[model samples]
Target chain A: MDSIIEVSGITKVYQKRKTKEKIQAVDNISFQVKRGEIIGLLGPNGAGKTTTIKMICGLLKPDSGQILINGVDNEKHRLRALTHISAVLEGSRNLYWRLTVRENLEYFAGNRGVSRKNVASRVEDLLQKFRLKDKETELVNRLSRGMQQKLAIAVAMLADTEVILLDEPTLGLDIETGYEVREILKAIAKEENRTVIISSHDMDVIQDICERTIIINQGKVVTDDRIEDLLKLFEVRSYTITLGEHLNEKQEHLIKERFLDYQYESNRIQPKLSVELLKTEDIYQLFDILKLNETPVEAIDREIIQFEQVFMKIVKGETTNGVDQVKSQSV
Target chain B: MEWIKSNLNLFKANFRKETIELRRYLPNTIAMLLTVYIIFMAMFAGIHSVGAPGTVDATIQNTIVNYIFWYLTITIVNGQGYEILTEATRGTFEQLGMSPSGIWRILSARLLAQGILTAAMMIVLLYLSMLTTGQSLNVDFVTIIPIFLLTCISMFGLSFIIAGLTVIVKQIQAFLQIFQFVLAALTFVSLSRAPFLVFFPITKGVDMIRAVMVEGLTLNELGFSNFLVLTTNALVYFIIGLATYLYCERYAMKKGLLAHY
Candidate 1:
């Protein structure tokens, strides 16, 4: 697939007002969104997701490096390149609060120089698609937050841009509304043949809607891969072992020595062990420790690590050894 | 042609929004009209009580003109730019920035809406003054119309400057308050009968308009020298305003300050 949006080596630095210290908001990040792909940009708070999104949509000029949209340099011909992109930054902040939903849609369409005849049809289509027809005449400020958010995305869609950038689309939303927004985004990505770059902290939204994710931490990209691959990679090494009896002091020390990280709960008679293996043979090492004590294993199940936990581990820098392990396994 | 098309659409959309918003503040508009009427009535009554001096009519007319100018300036500076600055603070500037239209078009549409609303208010005040005072009509239409248009453009230019400053400066509400005081002082000092003040641009515009409206000076009578100075002042102020706005735009882009409120 052709790359619809290519961000290369972008860096954004912000100067503190009082002390004048330079803060790196986005540091040397590069990523690509293929045509018709829904890519999630996931990170903790203050992770430069917003800065990267702003740079791509031409809201902020990066300190260095280039962004190309549809093979056109975004900085050189910003207007032309922006013609292929639309953004819903911070959700309802992009909307005209005083204007009605339909009016806002019409206004943005008219600004894009769409014909009057086509504007009505386009606005109607968006209203229907976003399920906002009942609130078409209501002022944006009067609508519920979820309705306002839906209208915002619908307005971006009205521009018919090839790429849509959504910054925290489901932030601060109720669970039901968040799920509704995720479903709407999923539908847009699947049915519209449009490329989407979503910056969000909602792990479920990313896992369900996005095929690939670019995870950032402290202004740098830690991992960028397909969602399936990340899940599978983290899953294989994770296991939860249920023991038949508590381990002795020596056995506990040995288990702790064998595993890179483990959690121990002493209250339970049958101790449970959650372990992440670095090597395939490490499982035998765990078994050997249990065998020495004649410990009965009630059950040992391979744990499926959720994307949220993987995200936490990646941000905490546990993935460096994991990457090394993967390299050795491939060799 | 494309610029015109885009600007016209922006103007229409923005004007609609402004109209809707202003509708909610109808009480303020009503109060303003009443105040204009009462102030003109009081001025007319005072002039009548002063035995209808030869300069009384001119003085009253000048006062009314000053009032209208300051009223419009305060509204534009305080109300219109306040809305724009609030939007900027809320990150709505990014929405406007991402649109196909240029910043100049957005600014122009806003100014156009302000101009129309100001003109409407001025006309209503003029009619109310005429009805109450029955002031003699001596204004030269040819010169007065052009002068009025220039004054409107000059005020619009100032409004743009204020909007641009609001983008760069953090505390715009305080700045706007200071601007209101400065504008009041400028209007008062320039329109007053002070010989040394004639060199100021505000004084020049006011004196020229007063001469045409009160003294019944025709274009030929005013001479090319007077027209040259008035137009030059208006043009220079307009150029300075545009230059300031361009500088602000570059600064905003460089500093990422466009959405900084």
Candidate 2:
């Protein structure tokens, strides 16, 4: 697929007002979001995710690098580039609190130079689709936070731009509302061939909706690949071993010493040792420890990993030394 | 035609927004209108109670014109700054910044809408003050509108300056409060008192309107030279204000201050 958004070597630095100390928010970050692709941008707090998103939205200028939206250079022609993009930047705050749901939608469309009459039907569709038709006449301030968020997304959707950037879309939503919002985003991506870039802390949302995930940590891209690929790579390294006999204290200590991330569950009906081995050959060392105890191995199975664990490892910079390095060696 | 239609759409959207807000904040709008009216009446009473009967009517007429222009200048000019501050606090400034119609155009449409409404309010105040002082000043919008519109251009220009500054500083309340007096000085001081004041923003337009309203001058009677100065002042101030605003906006974005709140 052709790329719709190209960000090349972007960096943002900020100076503390009082201390005058410079902080690097985004350091030489580069990525391409292909058309119709849902890419998740993940990072911990103060990791420059918002800064990078704002720069991509043309709301902030990077110290270096260029952003092209649909081949239009954002910095050189920010407004024109804006024509191809919209964002749900601040969630509920992206809307006019005093305006009704419908008014907010119409007003935003009008700002894009689309006449009110022209967008009336699309507004109705969004209202119905977002489950906000009943609240169309209600003031945004009076509505629930979830409804306000849905309205904010609806307003961005009303722009009908090629790319939609959502920063923490489900940040403060309740469980049901978050699920509803997730469903809405999924529906939008499935129906429209629009490129969606979502920055979220919800790993489930990322795993469920995004084909690719870009994990950023300390103003750098730690990992950029498909979610499934990362899962598969991590899964292959994790093993759950069932033993026919319980291990002695020495064997348990040695096993723990060998695999620092090992889990021993002798309290269960069956004795088991679960561990993730960075090197697949490390399993031989694990079996050697079992041999010393003369413990028979009942069954061995690969442990399935969760996206949240993958996100944690990637953000902690452990993936580079562990799974990512292993993948490079395999390649 | 495409340009016209696109711009008209922007204008209509913004105009409708302002109208809806006015309706929503009806009590606030009415209170502000009443405050201005009461203040004008108090000034009229002060002139009435004081001596100097010979020039009382003349001063009253001048005050009416000056107050109208001052009201228009302050509300529309300072309004831009207040609007930005509110938008920033509300977290909607970035959305407005992303508008393809351009933030400048949206603000221009907003100010124009406010100016029209203020003009309507000014007429009521003009007639009300005339009734209070029993000094029947001319109510000729035919002559006053051209002058009012020209003066509004300069006011809008100053508004742009404030809007730009607000984007950067984000706390322009103190500056805007001080600017109220600056605007007052510009609107109240006549060019005859200081001929150089003719070049100042809003001053020339206010003086010309006062001439037409108090001195019974018609559009043709005001002469083309008069228009040349007014139009030149409007355009010059407008260009300078817009340029300053655009520069500040780019600086704000570069510094990542677009939506700090």
Candidate 3:
């Protein structure tokens, strides 16, 4: 697929206002988002996801490197480059509070370069498509958060830009509303060929919608892979072992030292052991620890890993193999 | 032609938006207009109570010009900065920046819309003050147009400086308030009395307008050389203000201050 957005070695550093200490917000990050692809940007708070998204949308300039949209360098030709892009930045509801839904749509459509004659029809189309037709005459501030978010996205779409960047689209939304928004994004992705980059903390959003996911932690890209591949890789190592007896001190110490995120439940009558190994062959190491005390292993079953668990592992820096798997897949 | 066409579209969109906002906040607009009216009446009453009857007409005439000039200066100066601050506060600054019209075009359109509305309001107030004070004066657009145009351009230039500085120095209202007092003082400086003060961007134009309004002086009567001096001050200040704004904007983007309120 041809790349629609290329972010090359972008780095952003900020100095603390009081102490004047330099903080690396994004460190030499590079990625290419292909045309019509829905890429999820996953990261914990303060992980530089917002910084990266801002740079891509031309809201912030990187100290080093470039962002190109369809071969136009954003830094060199900002307005021209941004012509191909639209973004709903985190915390930027991006609607005039005083403007009604229809007015907001019309204003943004005109402001984003739609001709005066086309603005009304385009806004009407979006209003109907986004299911905001009922609330078209309502002020944006008066709408529910879900409706506001849908309007923000609808306003972004009014530009008809090739790439749309949504930062935390589902943040601060209720379960039903979040699901509705997720459905809206899903529909947008399926219905349009535009490239969509969503930066979200919700694992379900990444799992259900994105074709590819870029996980960032501490100003670095920790894992970049398809959500399926990550889930597959992490699921194989997760094992729940029914131990014949409670783990002895040496066995517990050995397991703790080997597995960083293992849970050993001493349930007295029926002790349980759960561990996620780095490798499939590493089961021998677990057997060795159990064999030391002649501890019987009643049954060992592979635990099903969710996208959230896989994400936690990657962000917690518990799995280098996950990054390696993703790196190899990208190649 | 394409550049003109695109900018015109932007201006139209922004003008419409502001108009909608003005209508939406109609009560606020009326309140602001009422406040201006009350202040004008208070100043008139105060002047009438304290001043000599013989000089009352002259004082009233001079006061109208001075108050208009001061009001225009502060509104343009404070208003330009306030627009930027409000955008930042609302978290809409980035969206405005990201628009294909660009920040400069957007700000230009917004300011132009505001300028039109303000000019109309000022004209209304000018007539109201004259009628209420029981004074009749010559209302010549020919004399007022040139001076108004010159002052607007000069003040716009100064406003650009204020707006640019606002991007870096978020707490700029205090600075603007101080500048308002300085402008209040500058509005009284007569070009005929102190010709060297023509070096000031707005004083020359204010003095020229006061001359035209009070003394009924024509462009030729004011002398073409004096007109040149007035235009020169406006042009010079506008160029400096534009340069300062462009520099500050570039600096703000580099420092990531564009996202800061």
Candidate 4:
């Protein structure tokens, strides 16, 4: 894959007005975006996702390091580099509130030097694709949040840039609109063959659309991996065991001692134990504890974990050394 | 050539947008029209009060000329420059800055649009004054046209200065109000005492216009020295405004205030 954007050792620090304390918004970070890749930038609030995206889009300059768009240094040849990228920042900042949707599209297209004759057809195609044809004549401010967001993306698309930077595209949309946006993004990534870097708190949107994910915490990247790999790695270790009989006090004590994070639910007729194992062999040790009480296990099933749970584990620093421990115990 | 093509498109689009915005604020337009009418009516009343019975034509011509100068200056300052300030306050300045077009071209186009509107207003007001006061229609088109053009160029320069101030101050409307107050006082000083204000550019322009319209002085009769001073002042103000805009652009970038609303 060809790298379309190369961001290396980028850092941004903002000075607090009252305290005059410097806050690091983006720490020394380096990442490369391949052509036609959909990458998700995930982080909690104040984790510098926005600052990082702004730096990449040339909206905000980094304190140190270089951002190369198509091998052109953004700071050195800003207009030239920016010509190949467009951004739909948070809260739909790219739009004109009073201009009608059609007018905004035409204006942006014209700004990009698209011929007057081509603007109409290009706008029509985008309006139809974004499902905003009916609202073409409506003022942007009058449109619903979902429509505004769609129009913003549509406008970015009209710029015909190779890379599209979307900051919280689904930040304030309803579930249906969010899903629609996700579908549109998927289509855009697949059909248009454009690089997309999305900074968002919506894990579902990230899970549904992005192939790779970069998780940031405290302005530093904690994990950058394929989404499926992270999900499978975290999912394989969780299990729920159905016990044939209730656990006695001694057996419960031993189980608690061995499996620190296990849960016992006594409400079910058979009773159930939910635990995550560092290794598949750890289940045998669990069996050893049940055997001490002569308690038989009826069945054991793997627990499917969502991306949100895997994210929580990674963010809490619980998964850093667990992968090694799991491998040793399983072998 | 490329710049012209791009600016032509930008100017057309911006002019259309401004027209839409102006139409939406119909009440303001109506208010402006009423204000212009009232000023003319008040001038007529004042002329009648001064025991000038048969000198209505001369008085009306004098009042119309003054009104043209005053109204055009006020409109350019408050109308076009105020809109630029509003755009700055709304964070649209960053949007414009990020565009490939230069700031000078964008602003110049806006001023050109304002000049056209001001010229149209002056013509309408001239006609209206003629109908109301029955002024002699013996107007010297050759003299009035050049005076009007020079006045507009000077006003454009002043508007640019005001726009630069608006960007630096951030609070556009308040800055404009204060600017207008100072301008009103300065105009009073210049008009009340001619010799004391002859050193000022605006006053000099007004004097030249009054000389030709009221005293019927030709370009040769007035000599080239006064024209040279007026032209120099306009050029100086325009250069100052451009320099101020460039300085403000740098300040905004360093302070990270371009995108701040």
lDDT of each: 0.77, 0.88, 0.83, 0.74
By DockQ, rank the candidates, best first: 2, 3, 1, 4
The sequence of per-residue lDDT tens digits that candidate 4 reaches over residues B1-261 is: 876677777676666555665676779877888788888888787887884678766666766766666777777766656766666554445455545454555676667776676678677877887788777443566866665566566667677677666655655676666666555543333344657655454666766776776677887887888778777766776677677766665555434555554
Pairs with backbone N, CA or C atoms under 3 Å apart (clashes), candidate 3: none
CAPRI band of model 3?
medium
Model 1 pairs in collision: none
Instruction: Judging by TM-score, tell me the better candidate of 3 and 4.
Output: 3
Provide the TM-score for each candidate, comma-separated.
Answer: 0.88, 0.95, 0.91, 0.84
**DockQ of predicted candidate 2:** 0.83
- How would the candidate models be sorted by TM-score, starting from the highest? 2, 3, 1, 4
Which candidate has the top score in lDDT? 2
RMSD of each: 3.6, 2.6, 3.4, 4.6
Query: Candidate 2 clashing pairs?
Result: none
Model 1 misplaced stretches (Cα beyond 4 Å): A113-117, A245-271, A279-295, A320-322, A325-331, B39-52, B77-80, B138-143, B185-206, B219-228
Clashing pairs in 4: none
Q: Score the docking of each candidate (DockQ).
A: 0.46, 0.83, 0.55, 0.26
By lDDT, the better pick of 1 and 4 is 1
TM-scores, chain B, all models: 0.83, 0.97, 0.94, 0.83
For candidate 3 chain A, the 10 contiguous residues with the lowest summed lDDT are A322-331
